[model samples]
Target: MKKFILIVVFSFILAGIFTFINQPQAETVNRPSDKETSNLFESLQNELYEIYDIGAFKTASNPNYTINEIIIPINGSQEYYDSVKDEVESLVKNIIKTTSFKNYSVIVEKNKLDQFFNEKAKDEMDLRYEITKTVHDSLYEAYQNQIGDIGITDSAQQLIIEVNTFFNGQESNDFFKEMENKLNIIFQEKLSSNLLVKESSITIHIYNKYGERIN
Candidate 1:
């Protein structure tokens, strides 16, 4: 009985040791210290700013010697971002290739300053709607004034301005094309002269009764 108890105890001890030896070891993630992360981010920031017109590096994360996330705060309108997006993308790609990092990504996020610009854009668009209405009304009036001399009659409710260049003895396609071209010039000049509407944002369309564009 004593020998059997000893054998049982010895077997339990051996099993425990074997189990400990076979267990998976916990891998240590060597995340960079806060100071080290800040320094590396600052260095990268200096290099980036030298070539690009952009804001500072808001935050960075480098865990286990791998640059995980490099966040950059952008403060500009959509148009401004569009102009710089390609350059920023190229810069990030170059950095990812040259830097010794296993995994990383750059984020260019819009900040408070950009939000302000976005609000401003919204305001401009609201005003633009009103300006467009003014342009349409003014163009309709101008079309009415010129249509009589040009020998055409058009409905007031309709936006189409039909010119009777087709009836003015020169029935060739050239005459109609020339008349349309001249009308376009006149309308463009009138649109440009308007104080309420932006000439760049507005376009005048001249169409015949057959739903075809004259100009």
Candidate 2:
């Protein structure tokens, strides 16, 4: 029927207009409408974004690892810590044993980093002490400065810089506690799935409200 053909042509025209109108808008929005936060998981991530304001925004839907460096509290377990301790220590020792200053590294360290961490120079426990010190230094900086607060990117920028420094070890511990409260389910699932790095250690750096490091 001629009427049927006319109806089909009109429908096609409507679709064409929608496609045209959305094309330019699509290019400008680096993200998507789905990127908006609604689920509890995304809401949680958004909270971190609000507080620390570090990494890019990811909805609960995006499981892509490169966009996310660390997940909170889920990785903050003592049992999890124990399982990975030997693994991390062994990796550190092997790297130091095989590599030298000429290795051309990224994490800047002016001191004799290799010799300081050499297994020949220090025993297993001592290596732990050294590693903890390094983690503490980095974690302290992150906590205080919020230098790279995972998904956080707006508020607490100035305050976190100061807070991460002044918060004592006790406070660092408490922060981990809160973090665990928020992301424990994800942390547990990741650990069970063995989704984290083989050589990494997820540490809990506690601090006092005063910004001093706690135990």
Candidate 3:
């Protein structure tokens, strides 16, 4: 009887050991450190700048390891930004998917610079668009469709006119200055009826057929 009891006890002990050994271990999650998260965000910022030529920054995360918001500074016109905003957001999403913190909710948006501008410059934007359209149509007609493209960059504080002409070697500082003067005349004529053109700074860039900024 003693021998049988000892064998039974030994069998129970062996079974218990086996059961403990076969039980699944709890999963270990490797959460990123605060420094690591900051580094990741910095890397993302650099990549965005390199790819899109836009300087974007991150706001403080809600939690240390989770990125929740990204701000894209609007350095161009509303029209220009609207044209590329979707593509830029898509690129950011794709990049985030490749990162370890993909599970975090990330929201990308234009900074308050644009929001404030849009709110305050609605009339200005309409007027500017009209002026640019008029200028573009006139130039296209005068150049016999030789005007390759006319792009505007409105940073809410200044206007930059980027003109590309198919006329090779025709782009010079003198030509650019002449174009600027013409633009100023039109702007003044249009803006004189309403606002004083609070943002009076206008920049003009002329490009040759080869897409080189000659002026």
Candidate 4:
């Protein structure tokens, strides 16, 4: 009975050792460090700069690091960007393949710098308009008596000032010119005084009492 018990105990110990050895181990995920990520960003940017005028580097990634998105802003016209978009995408894909994230689904997108800047300038001008509302209102009030209904609009990189005069008939070209010069000076002076106002060209449009554009 003692010999049989000893055999069974040895067999049980062997089974436990085999089970522990064969059990699958948890995967050790090597998440990228901050320094590593920065290096990768620099490397990708440098590669892109070699072929095109890059605006800025933009990237998005999830915690799992399975999906990565890179938005590359190219400084050129729409035609040029569209022509080279496929090439840019292929270049980016090839470069990414050499990295440890070879299996990651990399999505690349290209944007035109002109469109981006235009949109950004408009947004900035809108913000400035909101910030300098008091100044605008004061200027309008000061000029409303002289230049019958005055309307001001901020468009991209220009400040459009529309003046509807209370003149009985069509005004002379010289008259409109003089009015434009005067309003330009006043508007520039008042707007320039405010630091929030960006450097923008002023356009003056004059309309007669009959709603006909005089200038």
Candidate 5:
């Protein structure tokens, strides 16, 4: 059992973008300096923030954070929920600023049904689809876990107004909202034109420096 646990732990560590066991002790985080790191930060921030509606960002108090954190029974934990939402937005912005979609970009080509099989009569389509889903799931999970650690659950939206106000002022949030709306259209159009697939929603959650519930 111990060996099994150790192997599982090691596997996750090797697979993850950042190690949960090895983060800094406090907030004043050190920024990454390499070109790749810088580009990722900038792209992720730009892509994420510029894609949502103001209402979407306004406050998703009852947001779905199931992908990252465990949902507790107590629901009215406004501070907790609000904090989680705020952190998520903040991280979404930060991730937009940092990570590049090229890091996880996928090109899905819609081929004719005939292309899926070979002359040998082997069912290659089934195998390939499973592999694709598995890869997508893993990437989504890692993305979830990376930002999930700092999200505060059971919080409310007022927290967002507070933080955004403090950081860029309430009025700036309005401008961000406009940018978010335009971005939503642009990203959707871009996805439709390029990937030719429809993306329903792109949600995110953030965590503050403490790795605890911010609210």
Candidate 6:
């Protein structure tokens, strides 16, 4: 009878072990791989590029980062910004939802574009200064050859053209006026083409990768 009881107890233990082994394991959430995240970012960026009103967009992402960064540069007016703000927000949110990121942000800077363009503008400004100087020198040479002795000095905003009062026994204020006008025209024409010129201003927008403005 004891042997029968022992056999029954052993069978019970084995049944319990089998039941435990057959039970389902807890499920785990699958996170996106680095390549997958990169693909998602590029896809979203391409969509953003297709938007007519958006001038430019940049994306930054990392698995360890809780929030992603996206910068969009805008050159539109306040009216334009108001019009497209909602649409941009909606589009970004939808794109983010398609990804594994649970939290993210979008940034829209007022007038910040790529660094390359900014550097180019600075280089152009320097070129403008050099070109303007050359034009002045050329004009000075022409004056000396035709009108007589003169002195040219560079000042902060104006070029001082000093004429000898006794040059060829005549004072020519007309020549100075002509030189000044010519220089002004050249400066205006060249500087107008500059993107950094304040006379023509552009607006920039900033946002996070999730499409929220940074304020």
User: For candidate 6, lDDT tens digit of each residue in 112-195?
Assistant: 454457667778667545654555455556554443233344434444433332233233456445655664564466444643
Candidate 6 residue runs with Cα over 4 Å from true position: 1-31, 53-64, 68-86, 110-130, 133-215
Q: In model 1, which regions exceed 4 Å deviation?
A: 1-29, 60-67, 96-102, 117-215
> Taking the tens digit of each residue's C-alpha lDDT, what string does model 2 give over 76-185?
23454455444433432333343221121212111233334544445644534433344345454435543222211123221111113343344445566654443334
**CA lDDT of each prediction against the hidden true structure:** 0.55, 0.37, 0.66, 0.66, 0.34, 0.54
TM-score of each: 0.34, 0.18, 0.37, 0.41, 0.17, 0.37
Off by over 4 Å in 2: 1-121, 145-165, 168-205, 209-215
TM-score (C-alpha) between model 3 and the true structure: 0.37
Winner on lDDT between 2 and 3 is 3
Q: lDDT value for candidate 6?
A: 0.54
- Shift in Å, residue 23, candidate 3: 68
Best by TM-score: 4
Task: Report the lDDT tens digits of candidate 1 across residue range 71-176.
Answer: 6666566677677776675676566564433245667765566688779778756654444454445445645443321222224322333432113342466755
Q: For candidate 4, what is the lDDT? A: 0.66
RMSD of 2: 26.1
Residue pairs with backbone atoms closer than 3 Å in model 3 (clashes): none
Candidate 5: minimum summed lDDT over ten consecutive residues — where? 158-167
Give per-residue CA lDDT, model 4, range 1-215, as digits (tens): 99999999999999999999999974333555677668767887788887786677666666765555666666666677778777877777787676654544455445555677878888867756653464346545655644455666767767676667666555567876766676666656666654334566767677778887788
Angstrom error at residue 94, model 5: 56
